[model samples]
Every structure is written in structure tokens, then in C-alpha cells.
Target: MGRHKALPYVHRTFRGWHVRRTWVNTGEVSQLNRARIVSAAIDLIEREGADAVSMRRIAADLGVGVMSLYNHVPNKAALLDGVAEAVLSEIEFTDDPSAHWTDRVRAQARSFRQIAHHYPRSTMVVVSRQLQSSSGVIPVEYALSTMLSAGFDGREAVQLLRVFIAYIVGSLLREVGVTPTFAPVRPDVDVAAIDGGLFPVVASLAGELVKCDHDEEFEFGLEMLVQAMIVRRGARASTSEPPESGVIPSPGLS
Candidate 1:
């Protein structure tokens, strides 16, 4: 009987053959998949703004061909969806059934805030797009279910969810200094240039107004909204019972 000989692995590129090594791990090769691609894209977005993210850049970062990325993500739009999902997955929903709905809402809000702050550069990318990924849907579904189980009607639940989303996105934008229509102006702009007599109050508080503690501001606003919603929930519950004719009269009318 003849002894069998071991085969060597060859590494090739478009230019030429690269270094050949034995004992290649197939498992390591399989690790480069969709999740890895999405993670690389997210890292690119985090290091540089979304504008800096591209298939070519990501491929270079991963030491793969740009065309190879398409096998995982169809296009930039799909890649962005993945990135959004990746960001959304950072929010963990609590499984505690005994937690109050308001507490759940607060937890979600805080989670969103922390994630947004963690990736300040990528916040715009995360918040600007409408998320359709499962990871994105999980937190939303959790919040909606909590609200519905807590006695909020479909319309009220949806509207309240929108209010929370809008508040958080707006707060994130302000915190990240990304204004809607223009670059952020320096806070150190001279306040004395403005006529003090014409805008006395504005001039007086300019210093305080310019300096913001995003965490404190977010918490204050969130607490106020939560308290207001709590009052609204109580009021809604009180008026939930229908009249004698099964037709409840609208308030503030005859």
C-alpha cells in the first residue's frame, strides 16, 4: 500500500497568487457572512458618518472584493436596513410582567437614548430610516403590546408611540448637534452683539441656554411626557364606559 500525501491550500487574487498555507480552517472562512458584513458596515458608519460608508470601503476593511459584498447585501439601501437593524438590536426589552407600562416606556426611552449617544455619528442614519427589520420591529411590538394591554386603544397606542419616537429622535438630533436644515452654529457666538434692550430676556439667558446637559434635558422631557400620559390614561379610563344609549357624548360640546 502507498502512503497518501497532504494537499496544500492556494490563495489567489485578481493580481496574482498570494501566499499558500496549509491547514486552512473552513469554519473561519464560513464566519464571513451577512452578520459580519452588517457589523463591518455599522463599524464603518460609527467611525465615519453614513456618507463615508460604501461597498468598496467595507470590502477593503474586510479584505474582500466589493462585488462579494453584494452576495450578502443587495445594495446600499439594503445595507442601510441592516445597519438600522443592528442599531435597533442594542435595545433590550424587559420580560418582567409586573413592571408598569409607564416604567416599560421609560426603559425603552432610556435604552434608545443610550444607544443613540453611543453611536452619535450613526444616530442620523439609524433615526432617519424607517426600520422594517425584525430587530427593529421587536421593540416596537413590545411597546405597542404593553400599551394595548394597559387599556390604550389602537389609535391612542399608535399616536402615543409616535409621540415617543418623535421626542427621542428630536432629542437625539439636538444632542448630536445635527439641526434639521443647517450645520450647528457655535454656542460661543457673541450674545452682546444682539440689542439687549430689544430682547432683554433672550440676551439674559443666552449663556444658560447655549450650554445643555443632554441627559438631564432628555430625562426631564421624558418624565413630563410620561406623567402627562399617565393623567391621560386615568382620564380615558374614567370615560371609557358608554352612556345609556351606548353613545358617549363628546366633551367640550353641548
Candidate 2:
């Protein structure tokens, strides 16, 4: 009778798996998985741009067949979703019941911004995609819970959250120099050539205006929003009338 052969041993790496066969010296064979594929896609995007990321490209990077990636990612849309979720996972939400909700919100915003800064090229993937993963939902739910616990009604919480997200997206876009076609031109203009008499303040501070400290600006804007939320919460507590039948406003309603 023929002896039974042992199966290959699998070694996982951030990009993929290395399969080692004991029977023969086939060296390391690549096996694709969800995490590995998503990571490779992110690396590709960071090194090149979002346009550079594709199943074919990722599979090539992993030294695996393109069809092999389908078992893990299924399709490009699903792969993008996975990539977004992976990016979202980097945001660390602290579980501290004792901490003030405002502080918690501030921390969450800062954590998000830090991740954005770390992955500037890939940040848009997170912004553009609808988050369906638990890793993405958890932080959002935590933020909403914090606001609700601090006495924000459902509508207020949702609206405030939208505003916060908008601010972060806009700020990150500016920081990363990714703007729409209609965005103000950022060309190197001659500040001295501009007539000071026509635009005295802008001309005088053109150098300072151009030299942006994105971190400082983000913090300043976030603090402003936080203060506004605090004031709104206080006013709502004092002056807002209770709804009929204890009904909370639905976020879906206009």
C-alpha cells in the first residue's frame, strides 16, 4: 500500500499565506485571504493611488491567481467595502463610562483624524464608502450613545453627527490636497504683485493664509463644533418641549 502524504503547512503573512509542501521543494506558494487581500490593496493605494488598486493588481502583488482573490473578496465593490472597514478598524474608541461625553467625542474625532493623517491616500476610501462592517458601526454607535446619554434627542444626535462627519471629510480633503474641480486654485501666486490697496488684508496675510497648520485647524474646528453641541444640549434641556406620547424624532424624517 502507498504511504499517506501529509498536507502542506500554511504560514500566514500580512499580505497572504505561504504554503510549504513537505513532499517536494515547491518553495512558498501564496494563498489569498480577506485580510491579506485588503492589506495588499491598501498598500497598493498608498504607494500609488486609489486608481491603482484592483483585484488583478492585488492578486499580482500576492503572487496568486486573480480568481483566487474572488474566494475572499468576491468582487471589486465588496473588496472596496473590506478596504473601508479595514481603515475604519484603525480608529480606536475608548470605553470609559467615567469620562465626559464631550471628552469622549473629542477623543473619537482626534482618533479618526490621526488615522486619516496616517493613511492620507486611502482616507477617501473610508469617506466614499458606506460602512457596513461592525468595526465601522461600533465607533459611530458609541458616539451616538455618548450624545444620547448626554441628553441629545435622536434627531439632534444624527444631525450633529452628520455635521461632524462633514467637517472631518472636508478638513481631510483640504489637508491631503484632494479637491473638486470648482475648488479655489492653490497655484503659487505672487503675493507682492497683488495690489495691497484693493485687497490689503488678504495680500498682507497671503503668506500666513497659505502656510496652513492642518492639525491646529482641525482641532480648532472640532472644538468649535463640540462647544456648539454643548450649548445646544443645554438649551434643549431648558427650553425644548417634550414630544407627544414620548415619541423621539426619527433621524430619517426631514
Candidate 3:
């Protein structure tokens, strides 16, 4: 009689567990599909341009209908977020932490330059989408942690990120001279006619343009910034410290 009375409670507990399991399975499936969609979109955009990325294009690549993607993602804009996340996942960091801060920052800068070379359209995706996605924040968070461990505040860390990113991106853009927008290279146009007569100096020094390799410039810039920051920290310590404790930061080639 007691067993029968408690049967309802047992059934409810099992039912609740079943519901949770079902929801977990559904979530897993959704994530898998979203990853596939993002990978397909990245491939398409790399082969084509941002202007060429359409719902139909992505759907065709995914072997699913355009409406089917909406089940996982609300719209194309949301899908682009996934694509940017997918593109950023390719970045890998070295395991050696003993390297100088300059080396670490320069490594990250060089990675960006290489990504720009391999995936030219990725910059557009990164620029267009917000960094609200987890993939976008991973590298940024790594940068901040590295900076903080090296003794930097939030504002200073962010400023250095901005400066480092801008230098690498701008340098790559100049090096590649990609004719994506406003600058047009017609299919049938001659390569050296227009600039030869009008901008001789630009043409003359065109050969002097820096290579796509960013190791040298990145190291130099990172070295300067890190040194300046260390000096600033040292100056602050000297001004406000007990002369008895001479634990000032040793300024090295970081």
C-alpha cells in the first residue's frame, strides 16, 4: 500500500530527469549544427568576399535549406558572428611562458598579419561583428591576463592591445595593397600605366614596400612599448617607495 502511494513521486522524479536529458541532447545537436554552419561560411567567405556571402550560398554549402539555418541562428547577421568565431579559433599560442613580453606580443601581432594574408576577408568579418562571442574574447582575455601578470592596469592593457593591433593591421594593409573597396583593379586593366605617370614617387618606392612578414617591426614596436611601461612603473616605484626596500623592477629588453 505504501509503495503504491509513493509511485507518483517516483514517476515525477524520473520524468524531470528525462526532461533534462532531452534538453541536453537537443542543445548538443544545435551546437554541432551551428559549428558546421560557421565552418561552411568561413570557407565561402575566404573563397569569395563578404559581398558574396548570402543565405543561399551558405545553405548550399551546408547541404541544408536557407530556412533550416534559422532554426539554430536567428538570421544572417547572427551567423556571421559564428563565422568570425570560427575564424578566430585557428590562432594558437606557444606553450613557453618564459619568453619576454615583447616576444609574446610580437607573436600575437605576427599571427594577425598571417591571418590577414591567408584569410583576407576575415578582417571584414571581425570588423563587422561585435566581440560579444566567446571566440573573440579568448585572445583578448589572454592578452589582458598576460599584460596584468606583467603588471599593467586595465586601461593600459587595452591601450596596448589597440596600439599593437592597429600597427599590425595597418602594416599588413599597406603591404598587401589589396584592392577590395574604393580601389578598383579592373580585370583587363594594365598593371603599370595609371600610377607610372601620375605618382612616380609612389611607383619608384613601391618596391621598397615592406614585406608581409611582421616579426621585425612587431618586435621593435613591442620592445619600445614594454620598455616604456616598465620605466613608468619603475619611476612610480622610486617616487613612492621606502628607500630601504630597493625591489625596483629590473628593466630588461622586454
Query: Among these predicted structures, which one has the highest TM-score?
Result: 2
Which candidate do you rate higher for lDDT, 1 or 2? 2
Q: Candidate 2, 85: how far from true, in Å?
A: 1.0
Please list the C-alpha lDDT of all candidates, in the order they appear.
0.69, 0.70, 0.58
The candidate that wins on lDDT is 2
RMSD (Cα, Å) of model 3: 13.3
Lowest summed-lDDT stretch of 10 residues in model 1?
Answer: 12-21
**lDDT of each residue in 1-254, candidate 1, tens digit only:** 33222223323332222222244443455445776677677778878779988889999987888899988889998888877766666553454447767677888788777777766666667767788766666667777887886678999999988898889988887766666322225544566566789989977876675565678888999988876676566667734433223223445211
* Candidate 2 residue 26 C-alpha distance from true site, Å: 16
- Candidate 2 C-alpha lDDT tens digits along 1-254: 33332233334332222334345222332344686778778878889988888889998987889998888888988888877777766664455667777787888788778888877777788878888667667667877887887788898888888888789988988876776321224565555567889989977876665566777878899978877776566555745433323234433211
Off by over 4 Å in 3: 1-32, 95-97, 179-254
Tens digits of per-residue lDDT for model 3 on 173-224?
6445554322232334333444768877756654444223445655666667
Overlapping backbone residue pairs in candidate 3 total 0
TM-score attained by model 1: 0.74
Estimate the overall C-alpha local distance difference test score of candidate 3. 0.58
Clashing residue pairs, backbone N/CA/C < 3 A, model 2 = none
Model 2 accuracy (lDDT, Cα): 0.70
